[model samples]
Target chain A: MNADFLLKIDALSVSFGGVKALENYKLSLPPSRILGIIGPNGAGKTTLFNVLTGFIRPDSGHIHFNGQEITRWEPYQIARLGISRSFQNICLFGKLSVLDNVIVSCQIHERTSFLSALSKTRAYKKNEKALREKAWKLLCVFGLEKHADRRAMTLAYGDQRRLEIARALATAPKLLIIDEPAAGMNPNETQDLLDLILKLKEKFNLTIVLIEHNMNLVMQLCEYIQVLNYGRLAAEGLPLEIQQNQEVIDAYLGDTNNAGSN
Target chain B: MNKNKHALYLMISMGLFFCAVYLLDAYGNHYYQRVSNLMMIYVILTVSLNLSNGIVGISSLGQIGFMSIGAYVSAILTLPPGLKEHWLTGLPHWMSTIQSGLFPAMILAGILAAAIAFLVGIVILRLQGVFAAVTTLGFLIIVKVVAENWMTVTRGGRGISSLPTYTNLWWTSAVAVITVYVVLRIIRSPYGRSMLAVREHDLAAQSIGINAPRIRLLAFVISAFFTAVAGALWANLIGVVSPGSFYLWLTLLIIIMMVVGGMGSVTGSVFSAIGFTILLELLRGFENKIAVYGISSIIFAIVFMLVIIFHPDGVMGDREFSWDWFKRITPLF
Candidate 1:
């Protein structure tokens, strides 16, 4: 039991029917750190995220976050507890404007009652105005202010990805977990994303846990790395140490060959 | 500043609109007044349905179930105690002796319907997409069966007749305005935004700390409230209450009004409710003179098919009639 650690998980296991999605996963993360989780496809990276975010219950596990047990909380509860995530596939509210997406996210912690909103009271309007300004500030950081009124679905793919991160940040999360933020970007875009991730970490003093397939971005952005293969941990160390680990290399090579062949 | 101005404009327009409708009711013929009443009731129904079907993204056909609950409950409560004894012999003695006024009965009807909808929504809202719709459809069937077979309170399949006519153009339209006002308030509120997010993608909504099922339930319960009120109005208007009046046909009529009015647009729902009511009345006239029966159904079918083909998004695609449309005409005061 590390008193200073912000998130601690032990013996986490989950199975869907007969197949094991995650087995005996363990993690200890400190505050104000960037930890990267890398794995081949079907290696249970997303499954772990699902369990942590309360989308899926683990068959057996214990998860403690910010000195409280949160293993069985609902997704919305997890989010309100300052744990926010973005999806692997973009999940922006397609019909709402980009600004509205962030505004909705901002409501997680800063909520006005339904009655007050219905009344449109002075207090409610003031709170709403402050939140709207905060949302605009987030958009401005991501260079999305110009397109704040445009429908989220109409944004370019890279911008949509950026908007997702901005929306997540609007939750005022202590632990921000982003899944595959650089999945479809070009090299230049990936480089830009790496810079943005670092900048956000400094700006917000955030603890980030990201799963990425882009090796360059992962190597540049992560201080610590954990590798998984076939639902088992292959390596865990600093980024340089994981790069030199034989098991990690073999796992990546094997999966790359399979993916390339297909 | 703009928000206050928008609110003022809305208030003025709504006041004028109601005044015009009241005058028309006073001057119009019996046929015209009847059509207008039906239109207002449908407006209430479609707007409430829009909250669940369009805003919350739940395809529920169980609205007719809630409507039936409202109709029977209100009708039973408001019936004269003397008539209750003769019409519903199977009812308990205490129930037969209680005769409530129309206003309180309608309020209770709305509350009862909302309670049932809340309980049912908690269970069936967990089902995703079409499965949820199917479960709610089953709910509608069960309500119909209960209304038909439960002779104790409902008088079985024959239904209750000779009820007092408490509904008129003024009352119906007043309720309609209230419904619209409440719905607009909800749509502009934070809760409404959360409901819309749930409609877009439930998973994303949950991730953003919006409880998808809870939001859906809120919309469902509120929708049931207004839907029940509409049913109470309808029961009084026709001077009868029957299981047959609130069957799949009524559900289909409400859905058509929603689809043809642009599923997600409140303004579209209001206008489409008016448009279809007039169209159906015209077709009913044909059924009386011509040898053909079910002419109204045929016309409705044609209109639905045409709307689906040509204007699938309805007359308004998630757009509202806003005060901005009036800003240009201001006298620069």
Candidate 2:
């Protein structure tokens, strides 16, 4: 079989003060697919994302992205290498204008240096103009062009979440990881976000790793699903297969159902 | 809106400023000339410090250390061989003979400060918040102690005096304008945006491919360069270089100027520098009349207290003063 996966993780483990947050985790992800990671709180789903994105260093592991070993790369290096992520909580540049939030992210691709900027060289002006155009186009895509001059913190909560996604996409990533994007969103907003996520993947040719608690949305969008429980993989399979898996039913849904009945 | 109109406006303003400086140089009284020089020096110092304290969001109190380094280096470099022979008698043979012009010495001083800042930032930029600030404060103390005790190099606390006083109004104003232009360019650059992003949220910035530590280090080094240049110019203007001059009192004055001017606004920094210089000069004149020695300190304390109570964000509050303000006003026919 061809090693066609865009990302492959092997034997990843991490511990905090003798409490293993993640242990012996493994994954193989192909490109341009929506992969969902689901589990109860403290089940290490976000921990895995953190390690994958370089916020946390695992005790032991190897992660290969785009066929390059990336386990030891810094967060910024990993981001530059084509991985971008949105936080579980909205983390927009709150004091900046909505347009500037996207412009700063788009700056990762800018070629001009400090000297060029200081000189106000033709190249710097052209690059800055192009970047602004690109950022405006991105705002148009997310229906945020009207709010371009407003501060990010002044945006509505749903708009803030969408803005975070827009900022992430401005990096022009090959892989986009979104953590709890729909958490504070209403059902109507979540529905729109679901459509937006699917549209972005298609439009940008992006592979997506989504961590969400909204089961219906997850089941509808993800072709593959991995369920973690207490720092271990409880089940990994097709969405339907994971839905019917006995262990997942026992560890996650079973607890929820028991609490509901109580 | 067009580039040519903008350039023309800039040229007109710059031309006006140059005319004013030439007039001052030609006919202004000694007191007024001295006041303007102090204003320009303060503008350079405060604006550079604001790059770290305001843009990069690091409250660094070690600026005096870099300033002392620049002042001493430039003074030693530019001091006449006869003067060096008269004072600082323990100096090495080559050092006693070596002398350079003020311009090269100023540049060398800035380069040395930048080099030292780069090395120091590598270790301390990793620290966050007050921990980093305290470490910098410690750095200031260490530099001061070294300047005091290193008798061979600094002439101990006796300090170097009667150096060439070559810093005229033209030099100070030109350097101040250049400093402002360079800082504004930096703020509008991508690296500057990266530094601002790091200031906003370091983790978020890093996750987006902005290296926070490197951005901070760059800002620190750039700030050190400008600050050192200001100090070199100051040393030349006063014809004196003393360890006692660049102390906590000078640091406090600069920091207060930054705060009162609006910590993050370049225009505010310039305004505050000019305003405070004039205010201090007036207060000094008043003190001389009344035989009151510490009235200026009292006034400074009162001003700080009132600003904190009424307008803690300072005058401009992170906003730039732009040509748009002028463009918005139409002349009544």
**What TM-score do all the candidates reach, one by one?**
0.95, 0.96
Residue B268 displacement (Å), model 1: 1.0
Q: Which ranges of candidate 2 are over 4 A from the true structure?
A: A255-259, B2-6, B89-92, B326-333
lDDT of 1 by residue, A1-262 (tens): 5679899999999999988889899999999999999999999999999999999999998999998999999999999998999999999999899999999888887667877977789999898888899999999999999999999999999999999999989999999999999999999989899989889999988999999998888888899999988888888999988887878887783445456676
Q: What does the lDDT come to for candidate 2?
A: 0.89
Runs of candidate 1 with Cα error greater than 4 angstroms are A253-262, B1-9, B287-291, B325-333
Using TM-score as the measure, which candidate wins? 2
Please, what are the lDDT tens digits per residue for candidate 1 over residues B1-333?
Answer: 988987787788778988878787779898878788899999999999998998788999999899999999888987888989988888789989998766787899999999999999999999978899899999999999999998878988988887788888888888998888788888877788898889888988899899899999999999999999998988888889999999898899999999889878888899899899988888888888896988778878998999889987887867777767666898551
Clashing pairs in 1: none
Cα lDDT of model 2 by residue, B230-329, tens digit: 8899999998877889989989988988998887788889888888888898888899999989998899789988987898988887788766666669
